[model samples]
Target chain A: EADIYQTPRYLVIGTGKKITLECSQTMGHDKMYWYQQDPGMELHLIHYSYGVNSTEKGDLSSESTVSRIRTEHFPLTLESARPSHTSQYLCASSAMDRNTEAFFGQGTRLTVV
Target chain B: AQSVAQPEDQVNVAEGNPLTVKCTYSVSGNPYLFWYVQYPNRGLQFLLKYITGDNLVKGSYGFEAEFNKSQTSFHLKKPSALVSDSALYFCAVRAKAAGNKLTFGGGTRVLVKP
Candidate 1:
C-alpha cells in the first residue's frame, strides 16, 4: 500500500544527544511536512518541503533541520536534543493541489531527558 | 493569511448520541477545507473535505461535515457517537490559490461517553 512511514516510533535519549527522525513516503507526493505535537496541544508545523532539495521553515520556529534529498524522503535532524524536544513528530505528504488530501505517517514520539 | 479555527478545546457526547465538532475558517477567497482525526499516538487521518459543488461531504468512519460559505465554517458531525470516536479532531484550510500548504486549527478533543 502507498503510505508514509516514520522510523523509530518511540525514542528516549539524554540531553545533548543528536538524533534524526526518518520520514519517507511511497505516494510520490510533491509536498511534505513535519509537525510537532505535545500531548493535548495543537500541532505546530516546523518544516515542509515542496520537492527534492527544497525546504522551508514553518509557522513555528524549530531548532531542527530537514532535508529533502529525494521525493520520498524528508528527514529531520536535531543537532542537540533537549527535554523541550520531547514531543510527537508527525510526517505528512500531499500532492501539488491545494485541495488534495495529505497522507500521514504513524508518527515518532521522542523523549529527551 | 488562510486559517481554520476549532474554538472548543473539548466536547463531550454520550454514546449513541449525535456529535458535533465546530470549525470555522478565514480565507481571502473560496476556501478548501478539511477535517482530520488523530487517535492517541497516531498520525492524522483524513476524515472529509469540502472543495466545491456541494455543501455536505461524507467521509470515513461514518463521519460527515457540512460546508457553510456564509458562516465560513465546516463542522464535523456524526449521527451517533462511539467510544472509538474519542480522539482529537482538527480543521484545516487552504486558500484556493495557495497550493497544498494547510493551516490547521488548534484542534478539538472529542470524548464519547458511555
Candidate 2:
C-alpha cells in the first residue's frame, strides 16, 4: 500500500465555511496531484505540484487553491465551501521519472450543505 | 494535450469468465498508457502501465493490457474474472510532449456477477 494519506476520510460541513483538505506522502515523491471525482464518475485534475514551492492549476477550473511548502505535503484550501464543492478529492504522488506509475491516497469525501 | 477515452460506461461479466475493458488515447508524441482500478470509497490503484517494449504488459491482480500503437488503443484484460474484480476502472494517458501530465478517461464500472 502507498504511504500517502488524506485527512478526514469523510467530511460534512455547512456552506460558507473555510476548509482545507490535507494530503501528505511519505515516499518523497516529487510529483503530487489533487483530483476531483464524483461517485463512480470521471476524475478531474484540479491541482498539481512538481515539487516544493512549485504548484500549478490543472485542466479543471476550481475555486480551491493549493500550496506545496514541503515536499511531502500538498494541502488544498477552499476559501468558502459550497454545496457545489462537495465531491471526493483524491491525492496522488509519483516519482520524478515520467515512466513511473502514481500512488493514490484513500481520498476524502466532502459534503457541503 | 493528452487525452484518454473509455467508450463504455460499464462492462458486465460473469465470474470465471474473461474480461476486457476498452481504452483509446490521443497524444502528440509517443504515448504512455496506464490502467487503474478503484473500489467504492477508495482511491485508484495502479493495475498496469505501458511505457515501451512488448505490446502486452501484465500487472497486478492478474490484469493485463495490450498496447496497439497503430490504433492508439490500450485495452485491459483478465483471463478469469472474480466477484472481487467488480469496481471502477480508469484508463489514463500521458505524453512526454505534453509535459507528462497524466489524463484520465471518464471511467468504466465493472460488475462481475457470480
Q: Would you list the C-alpha lDDT of every candidate in the order shown?
A: 0.91, 0.95
Compared to the true structure, candidate 1 yields what TM-score? 0.96
- Model 2 stretches with alpha carbons more than 4 Å out: none
Off by over 4 Å in 1: B96-99
Q: What digit string (tens of lDDT, one per residue) describes model 2 on residues A10-110?
A: 99999999999999999999999999997658899999999999999999999999999999999999999999999999999999888899999999999
Give the Å error, residue B2, model 2: 1.3
Distance (Å) between predicted and true CA of B94, model 1?
1.3
Across residues A1-113, which tens digit of lDDT does each residue of candidate 1 receive? Answer: 23999998999999999999999999899899999986776888899999999999998999999999899999999999999899999999999888798888999999999
TM-score of chain A for each candidate? 0.97, 0.98
Clash count of each predicted structure: 0, 0
Best by DockQ: 2
**Which lDDT tens digits does candidate 1 get at residues B1-114?**
777789999999999999999999988878888899988888899999988987999999999999998998899999999999999999998885554578899999999999
Candidate 1, DockQ to 2 decimals? 0.79
TM-scores, each model vs. reference: 0.96, 0.99
> Which candidate number would show the highest TM-score if scored against the true structure?
2
